[model samples]
Target: MSEWTCAGPSTEPAYDPSDPQSGRALVNYHLRELGIGETHLVRAGEHGLRYCRTLVPEGIGVCRAYVLTEAAWPEGAELCVTVSWSPTAELCRNHTTGAIPTGAVEHWRQRIAATAQALRSVGFVVEPSHVRYSPVYHSDADLVVYRMPEGVPARRAPAAADWALTEPVPPNHQRRSWTYPERSPEDIVIQALRDAGLHAYHYEDPLPSGRVGARSITQTVWPPEADRCTWLTWWPHPTFVRDPGTGLLPDGAAQHWRDSLERIREVLTGAGLTLRTRARPWHPDTDEEVHYLAYRVPRG
Candidate 1:
């Protein structure tokens, strides 16, 4: 597991607080490093402080550039310009890796250096240790095993609804899926979809062997605006079906995928949603089938 550090100067002579352009320049310099040309300025007088918010590169996170006034610090420094990058909510949702990427850290370091340089050019005294380094962890496990912080409360698992609420369904986003080792109860899946404001259904299809398979599939259809569909399939066993000769999933293991077309047909008749399905070849090794389901959702 990788650890993160957040650093800033302990003490420094502040820059001219009356001049907001200096703050803007500091933020622009950092933005330039990310190849972003857009200028964002939050006037100091209007907000009682100056700050800039911009998207980080490679969708790693977001950067906030702000000026710390002397009044806020213990030492009567004129001003301290700070640039910080924390993961964006969306990025955090999608990234399973609980650590900041090295590339992201390097980008942040370069931006911090640029912001500090901008401050120094304006007569503010800067020090090498100006940037403080404190560790940041994405989860409690990371902290307990890595940092071993004492007196931290035991982490509790977040409720499904709570977790779902944290990630808003993207607008016009047609698909999302979740697979479980065991078949997730239909009621539970339906309730979750409801809580997340998504409409979907569950269908079970037998494999090519014509035996009742141990897989449960959920197909979600977004609103007409999204014009997209997503399928989530769950296998009860780690290996759904095995290939006799190679100890891998046989090609015919996915023959049951054709049932998805029938599932879509039912949706068209029962739910009034139109969808088209096409069968592609299945991968031999993984026994993965590439089925293309396309449709334009009917507009209300």
Candidate 2:
């Protein structure tokens, strides 16, 4: 018989009133203070508390960022604060801040350093001296990160002043598909068509492979068929689309594809385009078929 090795209870309890997991506890605490009903704890790794609305506890004594819930933020809201640690450490500023401070070049450096230290204290063998920073603007798609902590090399923090206040893209890069009893396929197709540049409407089309019956799609573009085409198209392979009724695919690959699609949708929407979806259908025969279409609606 093989013996099992138990690391014993995590060095710390899953819950500690003093430290309480940084992200969720902070979010839950804030939501409670605001009397926001039905608020749920969203597990988003380290950055979770940053997405939540309520400010983190002021006197926690140490400085670090946490993920916040995305849906809670008001549009275009900017967070500002000065982070002080080593007293003499530069008073860091954050304007276009998420849960973490932003706009303070020195503060970012410090946080990254602190995180490196925290990781090491937890027994990660990382070299903070080699750390470096890089600032990313107009993108939060890669906001959350988790590594062995100890083995990471130093990287510079992106200058906070350089970061613009905008919604970071969701880390997972997949399309978020939701089905509602009231939302019709035609409605979705029309919305996507208008989002794109060319004028289009829902047109009849046969579905691909095992799907039954044709669903909805954008019909045509405007300019009387101009010699130039301003539209581009791509399709998700069978491996990507899963039956919502049935959750299939290996957990990791499925989640990756899902997040990828969501990222693509955000990029398209950011450019004023929409990707309307329809029910999978048959009669189109093979897996390679136009499952959906996006048309650009002429902007006035």
Candidate 3:
């Protein structure tokens, strides 16, 4: 996924001062009346078409023209436009013939297909309308409508579903099934990064026996957001033991870093391990008491 820049509209307050929905209706009107091709006004859920300048103003947001076949259109000619709050709210005009660089469309189309396939393989429905190709960007190519399985919310849909069909299912049904993580608030977080987007996989790590461990939480922050900013991999725990007076380690420590002194002891105690509590900082200079349990899982 390409970086989702705040593109398509101006951030400045609208001079016309029209309500968002009304503004959308007005834009659709001009597209139809002006033969600007058919247009759609979309928001969170509701969407409609307006067909005159009176209906929608000319200056809207970035609009993309689609080659509408009788089949493509449910009613008449159809054009899909993207409206947003950004720097260029004025509707995007139709691109010139060959305006899209040669192979650009194909490139995005291929990416869409590949992403769709990957999503499907993970037990998702990869539908036709999901793959969109109208507005092309130098960095990103298309918009993909990712859908979830029968019971999941649209917001929590898995990515690139088609990939599931190719891989063989694991013998362990528990591991094979998709179990939304319990600890984390969201099952997945997709954010547009520089060249590619960051997809954070938040799920419980499955144990070898296919059973989720009590401490089964796992988070995979992909493509390390940037070079300078190191990603913080953290885990949380309820409580820990630490001496308040001296914030330094007592020495003879293996994995007994100051940060883990209290929390590790707590976890160990919780797991029925006999250990002594000591006062220490996670690092040499820090003095904050450590409560959230964390460890760096080795990555390949």
Best by lDDT: 1
State residue 272's C-alpha deviation in candidate 2, in Å.
Answer: 26
User: What's the lDDT for all of these models?
Assistant: 0.34, 0.31, 0.28
Superposed on all Cα atoms, the candidates' RMSDs to the truth, in angstroms, are 23.4, 17.7, 21.3
User: Distance from true position, residue 170, model 3, in Å?
Assistant: 46
TM per prediction:
0.24, 0.23, 0.17
lDDT value for model 2 = 0.31
| lDDT tens per residue, model 2, 1-300 | 222332223233343222314433333233233332123232333543322222232322233324322211112212111112221113322224522244444444555455445543533232322112323321110112222223444333334332222122111122123245433333434345345422233223312211111232111111121111122333344444544566554335444444444554564466554444433322212222233233233353
> Least accurate stretch of 10 residues (summed lDDT) in model 2?
218-227
Superposition TM-score, candidate 2 onto the true structure: 0.23
Per-residue lDDT over 1-300 for candidate 1, one digit per residue giving the tens place of the 0 to 100 score? 122221222233233445644653544454444443233333333445444443344444444444432211212333334344444334232234445544544444554455445434544443332112211322100000000124433233233332212222222122133344422333333343334333323234433222211122111112223232333222322244565676866454454444543443453334433333322233434443333222234354
Pick by lDDT: 1 or 3, better one: 1
- lDDT for model 1, please: 0.34
Model 2 lDDT at residue 216:
28
RMSD (Cα, Å) of model 2: 17.7
Instruction: Give the Å error, residue 241, model 2.
Output: 4.1
